[model samples]
Target: MEEMAIVFSPKYYEHNTGRDHPESSRRLKTVMRELKRLNLFSATTGCQLVEPELASIENLELVHDPEYVGLVKRICELGGGLLDLGDTVVSPKSFEVARYAVGGARKAVDSVLDGNYQKAFALVRPPGHHAGPYYGAGFCVFNNVAVAAAYLIEQHSFERVLILDVDAHHGNGTQEIFYDSEKALYMSLHEDPREFPGTGFVDEVGEGAGLGYNVNVPLPFGTGDEEYMKAFDEVVVPVARQYEPQFVLVSVGYDSHYGDPVGKLQLSAAAYESIFKKTLDLASTVCQGRLVAVLEGGYNLGQLGKLAALTISRMADFSYSMKDGTPPANSNVARRARRVIEKVEKAHSAFWKLRA
Candidate 1:
């Protein structure tokens, strides 16, 4: 088996969101270029680049409403229009491309579960996580990660799956999709809703049978490596250990980086490395490294490729590094993050045993 599998396709670039939109083909272009420049596909790296098939309507209906699926297709068929009132642009080819993106995510999961690779990363586009059951928002046309998680439970008969979302923004759509399913535990660390916007508050835990299965850590603005690592050590790690999922999925988003123009948080490159390392270690311990990471968000064109390449290199166990200059040290942000962490721990105290 290879060390890692990367699911990608040149077709991902066919979904055009306009030249000035933050969610553009340029992001993947840069990432693929960087991956090549760093020789990540060399024989020494033990990484394979795999193309993905288009996700069938049956696969989409696993999580989304069938009517919504048809609606998207019809819209794209009529040329191009916005899926949501804001930002989410779609061209004539977008519906096909979006299906391909979901297919890429599912392919990653299959690659890992089939023992073809120890781990996999689906580097697809039109970033999901913000798209919900019937609506698409936040430059997202479909909820890729959610569909993959649902696919695991419905198609593979998996009982326990964990989705760790490290996007700077909360995965509201993902949380919504699995909000009442105990089989999928959704955890997210994002900038405070007050700073950004949308859901992911501390009290919005799961409901019904899925109660306490949803976890959110809304850090303060300017939150950096120290705060993120602390939350990972204290909250994310403990909850995940108790959940003991059969597989792990990460909604990996680099928008939290300080260099990202679209994201407001202050995370550095080292912080991202630590985040990936912790997730890998957790997966290794609980699920025998059955992990697949799907790209979500990150808008800084200049740094997007470098960060993505670094992540892939790390997955391949190859040495590649990029520094984010000096890490930010803000005592105020630290204090706020501590409060948020405390609140999250307290909120979920009844669900899992947390470290004091």
Candidate 2:
């Protein structure tokens, strides 16, 4: 009955990632602040506030390996040492909160797929993407979006799906999970390999049967609206049209916004609005308005909040506008990224029906 459902739980704070970690509970706190400041909190109407359900191992095994899932459970159960080399730490309650994260995503997917909502956003933390089918990285515990996407495919009987990631860091896990399937297309536009976790290269473009289906647009540092749009126009839109998925999901991370300390690009609220609007256009064309966005990394709360509100407003199809004044364009990255994307366009044109 709600237009949108935003899922969150205070229990996500239990992960206890230790001091000075960028991917802390503080990030979600800021997102919560922004949502409240924008008045998305009223559970009475408009947006729905739903309790997060724990994602069963069955759902998790959709994107993660059974052995890896077992290991994570064992580590959380044993809970005396770090579950990861670093960035990801576990406590006695970690499995609960981590499950909440994945469960929240599933709930969102279910709500959307079941006709309970037009669209939904999962604001749970311990971001996924750096997580892989068998591993975790970049503060992610489990591939939350991956599990939920797989759920949509298996439980909902969907034929085609699109995973769009705008995270500053690449969505390595989502990419790995959906890499070889034409039924699922994973696309990411992120900072170059110069950044950490270092994947998302122009050439990664999925392997084997997924060849050319996986699109990675790696932008350089200081990329602004112009560059972002260029990537969208040249790569994202063109390839996506060919695939024409039944459902669309975005890995929405705010770190690419200007002044995110950990970020390399200089995207602003306006750029985000543009991207969201473009996504809306595509969703309207392909998925019958069935789209979902999950929270990824965005450490700067202020920027994140503005972008979040702007994103929701656009998703709700309100008249879109934003604050102005962007720095000069990073045309160099734009041009270089285009060359790579053009190759993708050529390689995958048969599947996606690229413009000649």
Candidate 3:
């Protein structure tokens, strides 16, 4: 077994939305091609490729409504149509492919927990962060990360799980699912929700026992790597250190890259490497290096492959960098980011030590 595992399946492509859809089969294909170009597929690469199983309906129900689960299947069976108002589309095999995506995430989690790999990345998609218990939106079918986290808490007896969503869009489904559960801590650094799915605000901290556990750092458009790293240093790193979770899961999305077609942020490919390095270090310190990352969104086919390969290289402890030098910081976004940090600190100080 390799030190890092990659869970994937070609079945993921069967969920075809359309040629023009940003979330197309070509995303995974590009990623796979780059991994090959980077020689990441060689037998000596120290990475293992694992196929994903189909997630059980029982497992799906852990984070989705049973009725909703049936509805997805029923809709697909009836020759598949739009899953929601528009963002999510379903083909005949989409239901099965989505289940496999969820299963891929679980496999990654299980691999880390079983000590077979220090970390794993699920390269499957139909990104789940936007899918909620009652509805699927933003190209998501089921809340894949949520299902994996709930599995850890309910089945494996793991108490503390930290979900770090670095997607361009807020993980609205993830936040809503764990909004009241202290067992899971949901943190997201997303494009301001005013853009889409519109929910991850500074004040939308968790409720009930989960109060202060949910953190959102909503950045304005044109925010670049520096601003994102600042948020990580001030908020993500500190909070992860304080939380000291038993396991860490990253909702990796490269859509924030400047080259992405759908997103408006200005992150460069290097931003992902920087973020992964920090997250990997955090996992080492707080969770014995047990970590798993799931693919969320990154529309630019050209950048996705390289960025995904770079992320896998980081997970495997290899050195690599993308030459797409990140653009200079947006000073205006920087000022606003500081304010957001202060607001988050005040909201969360009641629960965590904000300063060293």
Candidate 4:
């Protein structure tokens, strides 16, 4: 398998968010600038810049509401407005930027479909995972990764797509869209229900035929490096192996980084590095490394810079340094995370044969 990694950057379109917003344009600028300094983007014998193409509304409708899709277009036409409950702002360029978000996802799918690359990373913003089929929340417009997954199902006829969300917050929107389908498995590792947008409880397996397809491992606050890795080994990797997915898509949010303003989890850069490496290894065994990761959230520009570089390097087979030592994993948090994982395993034992 030929391993190639592509980063989709549309920082020029990051114009709608306010100056002080945590998900500001500077976040994208910071990642891009740091990646450049790290030289993973060299034009000579290095990462190639991949141009983005606009995703079709027909494709977008695969995962979003028609009226909601129309509303986004209309709001974008209104020059500037709020899409979410004031968390997401939209300007004339907002629609254009949102298109790039979707575009980057679609392009990544295309590259994989065309046999040009084994792995790709859509380093985009206006982070998704909070937006649903009919509503947008938490600084998101269209559910970019969901749109790509749906597009693959409809057009390419690819079955068995696994969405692995490592965001500190639950990917409620993504879970809602594919909740009742067995063809797609939605799993997430997030802070417990006490956290924001609070909906990912253990009992919320799924409704109808999709029973047991959704897995939610809610880690307690202050969960850091060791706790996160233990959860991965004890839960994430095993569940993924049992699913035997044909393709993998990750919602790679770095908001779990220790110093992130909006996040309470203490996953340091070392923890992030471990997960990145492990996920790539999982992709290798499952989809011949046919995995695509999108930027979700990481507030501290310094931490984001370090984590993003580590993500690119691992997926691209480059070398990098891990932080000296990650924050200590709490014993209480570990106990809580394991309980959550065991409950999920019991719930879905029939589906994926998850071991306790």
In the range 105-212, model 4's lDDT, one tens digit per residue, is 888878877888777888776778888999888888888888878877777887788898888898888999999987778888888766467688777778887787
Question: Worst 10-residue stretch by lDDT in candidate 2?
Answer: 316-325
Indicate which candidate wins on lDDT: 1
Instruction: Score residue 156 of candidate 4 by CA lDDT.
Output: 80
Using lDDT as the yardstick, the better of models 1 and 4 is 1
Rank candidates by TM-score, best first. Answer: 1, 3, 4, 2
User: What is the Cα-based TM-score of model 3?
Assistant: 0.97
Model 3, runs deviating above 4 Å:
none
Q: For candidate 3, give the lDDT.
A: 0.89
lDDT, candidate 2, residue 208?
A: 80
Q: Give the per-residue Cα lDDT of candidate 3 at 87.
A: 68
Q: Return model 2's CA RMSD, one decimal.
A: 2.3
Per-candidate TM equals 0.98, 0.92, 0.97, 0.94
Per-residue lDDT of 32-65 in model 2, one digit per residue for the tens?
A: 7877766675653377677788888788888888
Model 4 error, position 113 (Å) = 1.6
| Candidate 4 Cα deviation (angstroms), residue 120 | 0.5
Q: Which portions of model 1 show Cα errors greater than 4 Å?
A: 195-197
lDDT of each: 0.90, 0.79, 0.89, 0.79
The backbone clash count of each candidate, in order, is 0, 1, 0, 0
